[model samples]
Target: MIRLDTGAITEIALLAAHCDDLAIGLGGTLLTLADSVPGLRVRALILTGAGTEREGEERAALESFCPGADLDVRVLDLPDGRTPVHWERAKEAVGELRRGGDPQVVFAPQRDDAHQDHRLLAELAPTEFRDHLILGYEILKWENDTPRPSLFHPLSEVVARRKAELLMKHYPSQRDHDWFDEESFLGLCRLRGVQCRARYAEAFLVEKATITFGGA
Candidate 1:
């Protein structure tokens, strides 16, 4: 596989429909990126779980994942699983984030996600951040919705293990879910790693990106 890197990612935008979505999907990638980029700026927006325990959980989880980075998170109070009903508000929130900063890369759910809320935010992401590279992260769930990702971010064993540990540590509220266990999280990472010839990896679907063939 030919490896390509985004030269200098000083700023990133993360969008999620639910609280633990980002951690479940891209925690390892965040860990790897945060370690490489000094003073990285992370702007995150979640559609639901504001003014609740879930919101607090998200803030703590993100801070743990992106250690030492400038992390700014906003959790909206829009009803979970009913994002389509609040379409206007969701769009506005995305727009506000776009105006707040121009990130070199954006992480969001894919359009083909089985969950309605994820799909809605995925649809709206490109509408606001049209000129940016957007990577669609996947959430493992009971539904048969795992995407065949076009891009893979390989992870070190330590980073992969740390991602799982942080998820279990920071999100106590999600521990009851059958799929939230360490086995499930690590299993997915290991499988993706096999696909990309690594011990562990986080895969993403790239909807749009610009590749420069040679030096300027």
Candidate 2:
């Protein structure tokens, strides 16, 4: 288990457009948080993939990634590639998730991502989670080709391997694609890890945060 020596963050929500997006973007970080903070709850709100095989894959993947934690896997029925077409419904779905509780940290794709669905989700996050810290995960798409991510969450080698295993085990839809292989996951983590002097890491772009120099 990867132990992070830190205080517990109240909650964390991983918002993504697809099943593998959460795993590909912040799997390692999720692992670290769950292992280190017993109070931590990881909720994944997949904006798309509602009535598809991908949604099943996402459910299984989240269970494996966050064991013994509060895990809520929701698939908003909004059509893929048409989130903009149903903006109100999408916003209502997200707002419903943000109703009972608020997370200390929220993760979503960058607004500049190549995918229109991702961009729309990022834009919608702030509207519901205005009081929380928001971090945008970079999707390796054309628009985010040169993402200068400002935050790095280091991952141990073992956790990195677990991430790869979960990816392959849960998401079989992208197995044929070479880019979704274990090698690619490790490569990206290693590249980001270099910035933080760790064997592996996940990069994130921070939108806003409340910082205290010493004491809160």
Candidate 3:
């Protein structure tokens, strides 16, 4: 398989319906980019979990994942499991985020995600970031919602373990959840790793992509 570089990108935007979603979905990717790209700018907007311990955990987790990078995060106060009910506010928030800056890539939840919150954000990402690469990420949960992703960002074994470590260390509030453990995180990464022939990888689904093929 050929490794495709995103080319000299300096900014990226991330959208998640909840905290920990980004960490669970693309922490390794963040870790990789932050380490390789000097002064990378990462902007994140999460629809829920504001004013709670989850928000604090999210800030810390992202900071840990994206060392040596410019990181900004905003968490909105919205009801969990009811993103569809607050469609207008959610859409507006996404729009506002778009107005803030133009990122080369946008990471959001997958449309086919079994969770409504995840699915809603996934659907909304393309509407707002039309000109960018919208990488829809998967979150593992009790529901059989794991997607057959077309994109795989390979992670080194160490980075994959570091992602698991950071997830467990930062989000203690999610510790009780049955699916929120290092083993499960590594398990999924391992599966994706087999597919990509790497020790580990994070998978994503691409709803749409634009490519240019000519060299001047």
Candidate 4:
């Protein structure tokens, strides 16, 4: 596989349908990026779980994931699992995020996600950030919605373990869920690592990417 380097990503936009989505999908990658690029600007938008314990969990979780970076998080009050009904609000939220700044890359839910809220945010992301590279992160759930990802970000053993640990520690609300555990999270990362010849990794679906053949 030919690797393409996204040089010096100073800003990143993170979009999610609910709390814990970003951490579950791209926690390791966020850790790696923040370490590599000091003062990286992270603007995160979550569609649901505002004014609840989940919101606090999300803030703490993202701060842990993007250490030393300028992280700005906004958790909205949209109804969970009802994104389609609040389509206009979702679009407006995305638009407001787009107006803030231009980011080199965006991490969002994939179009094929089984969750209605996730799918709606995925569809709306591209409409606002038309020219940016949008990597669709996968959230492993019981719905069997994982897609064959086109992009891979290899994670070190340290980052992988830390990600699992942070998830368990910060998100108490998710503990009761049957699928929330270190084994499941690490197992998924290990599987992706196997796909990309690494110890552990996070995978993303890229709908399109521009490749420049010649030197600048």
Candidate 5:
């Protein structure tokens, strides 16, 4: 089991095309990180949410999900479902955010995802963040598209359950939908955890990888 001493990571950034994309994709992982570290910083960059109802919902949800940490949220008014068309703007926005200092880790979508927006974001991310670690979180909607994830982080059952609860509590828009519920979220975590023999887990697809060994 990969027991990450989350205290080691001070800053984390998550990039997504929509409001719930980050939560749906890496909510459990984020929760685990927050719990593991006392002063971890987190940022969620939403490429869409331009004058939409989802924008307010995202704001509320993020505040609830990440309580103590410095939650930096930037909702770009870019057209939804058209990230590939406006790739330059997306890259520029990301570049502007990481100018002063870079986040220790960044989580974004896979380059070959079913959704064009996700794929585009993944492509643009590399342009700005060439040296840092980039993790691609998966969303199951468009299709059960799996990209052979290279990194897997196990979340405690408590963390997994809390992630689901936060999703339900924060997103009122999704509650009416048949798919948004406590059971399905837990089920997904359990299933992913099975891949690494953990009770609950979140998985990521990686475009590049680097590792250094510190003697145990």
Candidate 6:
């Protein structure tokens, strides 16, 4: 079990099909980055929930999740769960994000995700971020779409607890849902932590990565 450093990650890109997806998938990772890397720049794109309460929730949650980071986020009006129907618009949006900047890493959903919206974005993101490190994060929903992620971001017990707390506090709109509970969020971290031999951790599916040993 070798430990690796997330070297000089000054900027990152986050892609999600809907609001809260990024937070649910890697909220703890965001927190860890914000704490370790001061002034981290983050650019995020969500295909749905523009001009709605869900969008508002996302903005606030990200701010809290990535405290002290320069964050730019966009939530589009594309209809949720029907991403394939609006393929052109989604593709253009992703291209626009690529034009914005080149991030050191990209976070996205799994290409084989059960949810069509997640899957579509997962498939499309690589087209734009071809040479970047892209880590696929998983959303724990009703669908049996749990990913067998090879990469694990180890999280402290405190950070893990805060992720669950912010999730409950910021997204009041999602409170009605059964899965929107502290237990479910922390439980996933606990389960993944066991795999990585940590107190708590967040898992990521890595499609590709280039190792530069000894600083290349």
* lDDT for each residue of candidate 4 in 143-185, tens digit (9 for 90 to 100): 9988999899999999999999999999999999999999999
Which residue runs of candidate 3 sit more than 4 Å off their true CA positions? 214-216
Lowest summed lDDT window (length 10), candidate 5: 1-10
lDDT winner, 4 or 6: 4
For 67-182, candidate 2 gives per-residue lDDT tens digits of 76788888877787888898888888778778856788889988778788888889999999898889999765334364788888888999999998888889899887757788
In candidate 5, which residue ranges exceed 4 Å CA deviation?
A: 1-7, 214-216
TM-score of each: 0.98, 0.92, 0.97, 0.98, 0.90, 0.97
Give stretches of model 2 more than 4 Å off: 1-7, 141-146
Measure candidate 5: CA RMSD: 2.1
> Model 6: clashing residue pairs?
none
Point out the worst 10-residue segment of candidate 2 by lDDT: 1-10
Q: What does candidate 6's lDDT look like per residue over 148-203, in tens digits? A: 98999989999999999999999999899988899999999999999999989999
RMSD of each: 0.7, 3.0, 1.1, 0.7, 2.1, 0.9
lDDT tens digits by residue: candidate 1, 1-216: 779967788999999999999999999999988999989999999999999999999999999999999999999999989989999999999999999999999999988999999999899999999999999999988899999999999999999999999999989998888888888999999999999999999999998877788864
Q: For residues 1-216, what per-residue lDDT tens digits would candidate 3 score against the true structure? A: 766667787999999999999999999999999999999999999999999999999999999999999898999999999989999999999999999988988999998999999889988888888888899998988998788999999999999999999999999999999989999999999999999998899999988886666741
Writing each residue's lDDT as its tens digit, candidate 5 over 109-129 gives 988789998888888888888
Model 6's C-alpha root-mean-square deviation from the true structure amounts to: 0.9
Q: Which lDDT value does model 6 have at 162?
A: 99
How many clashing residue pairs, candidate 3? 0
Which of 3 and 6 is the better model by TM-score?
6
**Which regions in candidate 4 have their CA more than 4 angstroms from the true location?**
none
